[model samples]
Target: MNGTNKGGAAPGRGGGLASPRFAAVMASQALSLLGMEILQFVLPLHLLNLTGSGALYGGVIAAGFVPYTLLAPIGGVIADRTRKRGVMIAVDAVLAIAMAAYLFAAGTSAVIAATVAVLMLAFAAQALYQPCVQSAIPHLVESHEVERAVALVNQVGMLTGIGGPVAGGIAFGFLGLAPIVFISAACFAASALVVAALVHVPYEPPARTAGAVATARADLKEALAFLRSRPLMWRTIMAATLVNLFGSSFFNVCSPYIVTETLGLPNQLMGVLQGALAVGGLAGGAIVAAVPGTLGIRRVPALLLGVVAGIAAIACVLMVPLPALGTYTALVILYLPTMAVCMCMSIVATSYLQVESPGTLVGKVMALAIMLANCVTPAGQLAYGVALDIVPAWAIALVAASVTAAVAWWLARAER
Candidate 1:
């Protein structure tokens, strides 16, 4: 169907606000995210239990992103040229099988090998599936509704983020890692089934010249050239890269360490902290959903950078000592909201990019941007690992906060 009707509302298969098929797709994605959140905690914890090496744990996380750098462009091409729904289903099935294999072989050398393989496949699937999902939204909804649609998706993800870790930790504590992996596999299978039942996305036509190598090269070049032409795109990408480097670096190791080391909190408390951040993210998503339609898209990127700056500054303050339980609780409360604001801004920027960019080029641009952001994460984790050896945890946190604030401001002003 054409994207719009004479009334300027988004046209769906039937006369409705949103296509049922599209809603089903969203539901599947939400479930998939929930499962992913569980695995996010379980995987690293398992690695630490097995090896106890910070560097090795960091490497395992880095390996997943490495394929995105190498294969995302290709994945984008496949998404555009093939049937997107089928591609998603195939990818999901493969991931589920791989995860199941890992579960069956838990704790062996084979388990690690299989786990890495499954993660790589999952990463590739994620790269392809994201663009397909984003591209599908415009087709299913009105242009004016794009922002709301994106916000809803982000909200679902955030909600899952809040629950996934808590559930994962419980499962790990009670059922062990094998059960966690099996459950994750089941979630992926469920997601695939939901997609199959609900979505009827149209199949893309095949390329006219089936084996046209030169045409593929041209597509890659054009996507890169388009990115280079937009200064704001480059600056936004740089901003996101730096933010991920400083902010998420600690996420890979610090939260677990903090719970176990500093506060002498239990694993359950660690789960709560991780889940609380997601609650903050959900609040941010709500704020984005509430924004008026008249504002310029350019404001999104700038506001997001500002929020990042605020987060860094607030983090610095939270690092200070408190004499009482009540004071520390107040500080934690304040820090959570700051994190939410930063996450909300970032989500808005992501939505703006998805809507503003051309459909054919969107996949490549997103892939490249994510790859750049993720590539540096390993380095950040490595830095944190080394710093933890010499510098105190609070000092490392302060340094990270300082660097993030500086980078955020630089990014805010860079394009303007």
Candidate 2:
């Protein structure tokens, strides 16, 4: 039901994402993502390089997520109430300004605190902004087109994952970090203008008199009630949350540990492993997009749980000292399947979540699901670190895998 055309762009003539608005937004996404990824790549590396303390760097990085998790639900509520196009435009503009602020903090400690604050705000803006874009997809296309649409949307990110970092690295190597930041700023600003001129879809705006806090609260309550009514979807969300909490935690804390401490490998190898996962994610998103209707709601939990199991297997293999296979080989063998499985899980699961709900509730529901799923990530990462000191890395992985398996099994049974 391609609804109303508010701003510009003709309605897509066919069900195959024929809307010019979709193309416009996708173009905006590409530019915006290219900017964001460069900054995301450059920032942590800069921090790590400057501090030379992983603890300090990780702590600073973790701190940014605090606002993201808390503000994401509010963002969802706003998306439901306002035109998503405007929300995206505003967020992008502000992010561009934030990047400019970081430029001031680029060389010296003069406004180090300000730079960090700006970075935190930028991260929060991103977390908030994502729900709006995701919620906008169904409004732009017919119901049957959602899977392909979401997959196509996801491809923007996948493409950025491949291009952004490499370009960021090249920029950093040749022109330095400041130039990359400047380019990022320009990208967001350009994206704002593109989206402002193009996206057109009608959504019900909430009452202006109600304060944002109250509106957000009401929106979240409604989303929770919807979750209460849908058993399978709720289970998928919860299972996904548990996996996000521990699975990412393991990687954030334990993967490096496995690579550096346990595997006794160089630091560069870690980058290789991360690149592998990014490539794997790109491959997975393309697969989902190409296969159109494969993402049934009931099938999602199994796929996710299977991914978790793959992580467990990868963890177990890392513990072993293979005779002929080198560290790189073992990493390739263990990492590929786990990353690929998770990639498939993410492609199927998130697309299902975004398009399955009613448009009115989609934004808030998407935000709440993403926030709840990700809220514990930082703390879980810290906990994994602490746990590693008390227990061993291999021991921790075994427990994590078992817990993940149990959750997956429970989800599977619930779905049946």
- Output the lDDT of residue 297, model 1: 41
Indicate the TM-score of model 2.
0.84
- Assess each prediction's global lDDT (C-alpha) against the native: 0.66, 0.70
Model 2: per-residue Cα lDDT at residue 297:
60
- Deviating ranges (above 4 Å) for candidate 1: 1-17, 109-115, 210-213, 292-297, 300-335
Worst 10 residues of 1 by lDDT: 1-10
lDDT of 2 at 293: 62
Which of the numbered candidates is closest to the native, going by highest TM-score?
1
Distance from true location, Cα of 249 in model 1, Å: 2.0
Give the clash count for each candidate: 0, 2
- Residues 1-416, candidate 2, lDDT per residue (tens digit)? 12232221224522357678778878888888878777766676566556544454445556666788888888888778878888889989998988888877777775446545765787788877788878777677766677778777877786776577666765665677788888989999999999888876566555666777776677799888987797766777788778867776676556655554556554455545555666767777777777766656666657766666767776667567664237557656666667666777776777666656765788888888888787877777567766655666667777677778887778778867
Q: Estimate each model's TM-score.
A: 0.86, 0.84
Per-residue C-alpha lDDT of model 1 across residues 1-416, encoded as one tens digit per residue:
11222222234432222578668778888777776777767776677566655555566666666676567676666655667788778767876787787766676777666656666666767777776666566556666676777777788888888888878877677778888888888888898898887776655474555365666676667767876797776677777788678867765565565454455545565676777778887887788778734334455445554555544554554466754343335435654675677666666666666565666665556666666666687677777765654565666666666666677567646647
**Alpha-carbon error at 404 in model 1, in Å?**
2.2
